[model samples]
Target: MILITGAAGYIGSITSYHFLKNNYKVIGIDNISTGNARALEVLNKFDNFKFYEGNFGNLELLEQIVTNNKIDFVVHFAANTSVFESTQNPLKYHDNNVSNMINLLKICEKYDINNFIFSSSAATYGEPKTNELITEDTPKNPINPYGLTKLIGEYILNDLSNAKKEFNFIALRYFNVAGASLIAPLGQFSKSSLLIKIAAECAANKRDKMYLYGNDYNTPDGTCVRDYIHVDDLAIAHIEALKYLKNQKTSQAFNVGYSKGTSVKEVIDIMKKISGNDFKVEMADRRTGDPSSLVASNKKITSLTDWKYSNDNLELICKSAYEWELKI
Candidate 1:
């Protein structure tokens, strides 16, 4: 069985559903702080799925779960993810993202659960000197507390792997993860400030207008450029990472993206075309840790793992998110 932390959140819930559909028994834990109850309910429908509602950092809870269930692999997703919020409250991010991760790693080591899948982010790259597609070897200079915490997690994993010959991990550094599940009622239910989600809300008439954080960046359209990957495609990347770890006892980090860059204006245009609604978009100053451009060179993941991109189209991504937004 596999243990999934933050299994009620957007990406975590969807990934857990994928694993369950593939006939894998999943044990999920979530504190419901940022996770959606509806997503948890959907996962509860599966017979192979079991859930524990608590903080993943609670050592007593983790100890009970680990002792009771014979978990083989761990997929960690629970952490603070907001860049702007992290800037204001850095200690919370460090406590939740960094310290809690350390606790989880300790439990994993104690139980001898050697295989791990970490939910890292491209924010760890910060603003690169050149606007080139980022590779795994790129310098990690995080500009925000959120990214720093994730980078520190990667460092801990790397150090642990070097020290322990039996332990291995795969850190899938995600790009701009957007869109909802193509399947019904399994999308992002929690409120978010993500661009696509906000655009979808405007299309659904849930929001009067959406704010574009910055439009004077050093990009083609003076807007930030990001690599948008569908949530389902990213979920597949995790499964493929697990398979790779099972086959080879080596630790690696792969970029999970389509190696393409879409500007903020382009994304809004696509969302407008797909949703048939030209929602009002107001410009504002750049957020604290906003990067001008962050496109991924997904060559590493594509070449090394069995993962492939199926929903790489921008229109499909916006449409899927719009449809789900209409429901919630």
Candidate 2:
């Protein structure tokens, strides 16, 4: 069986549904610290899904689930992911993102759960020295606590794999993950500080205005550029990564993105056009640890696995998020 941590969160819930549809028995765990109750309600409809509402830090609870379910693989997605908040509370990020991962690694080692997949982020790349596509080989130089924690997690996995040959892992460093599950009717429901969600909220009149962190970046339109990959495409990448690990039996990391860059102003314009609502946009000073541009070169994952982008259009992403916001 496959175990998915943070199964009630945005990407995890959609991934659980994807696995169920593919006839995989899944054991899901989440503490609901930042997860939504509605996501759990939707996931409860699947017969192949068994959920445990608790943190992975509970070793006894993790032991019970692993022993009872015979979990052989894991997709870990639980962590505090706010870049700005991580700046204010670095210890919290280290404890939750790094220490919690060490705890989970111990459980995996004890239970002989060798196959593992991690939900990493492009934040780990920090400020790109160039405006080129960020390949997996790019040097990792995280600028904030959030990105540093994730980078440390990657280091721990590498160390474990080097010592234990049986342990194999795939760390997917995602760019900007947005949108919602069109098929499952699940959206980004967490109280997120992400740009797309905040923009969608403003478009829906839930917020007064959306603030652009910086409009003076060295890019087109003088705004920061990022590669926004739909949540559904990211879910597919996880499944493909799992399949690749089952056969390769090696530890590797891949960049999960469209290899294209979109500016902050462009995203706002797309959201406005899709929602048909002209919300107020305000310019703000550059936030600390903000990067000028970070786009991914997905050649590694695309060539290595059967993963392909199903929803690469910006309009589709905005529309899916807009529909989900209206429903919630």
lDDT of 2 at 122: 96
TM-score of 2: 0.99
**lDDT (tens digit, per residue) of candidate 2 on 158-271:** 999999999999999989999988788788886688888988898888899978988888898999899999999999999999999998888899999999999999999999
Candidate 1, residue 226: how far the Cα is off, in Å: 0.2
* Weakest ten-residue segment in model 2 by summed lDDT: 182-191
Strongest candidate by lDDT: 1
Candidate 2 at residue 39, lDDT? Answer: 91
Question: How do all models score by TM-score?
Answer: 0.99, 0.99
In candidate 1, stretches whose alpha carbon ends up further than 4 angstroms from where it belongs are none
State how far residue 28 of model 1 sits from its true place (Å): 0.1
Q: Candidate 2, 298: how far from true, in Å?
A: 0.1
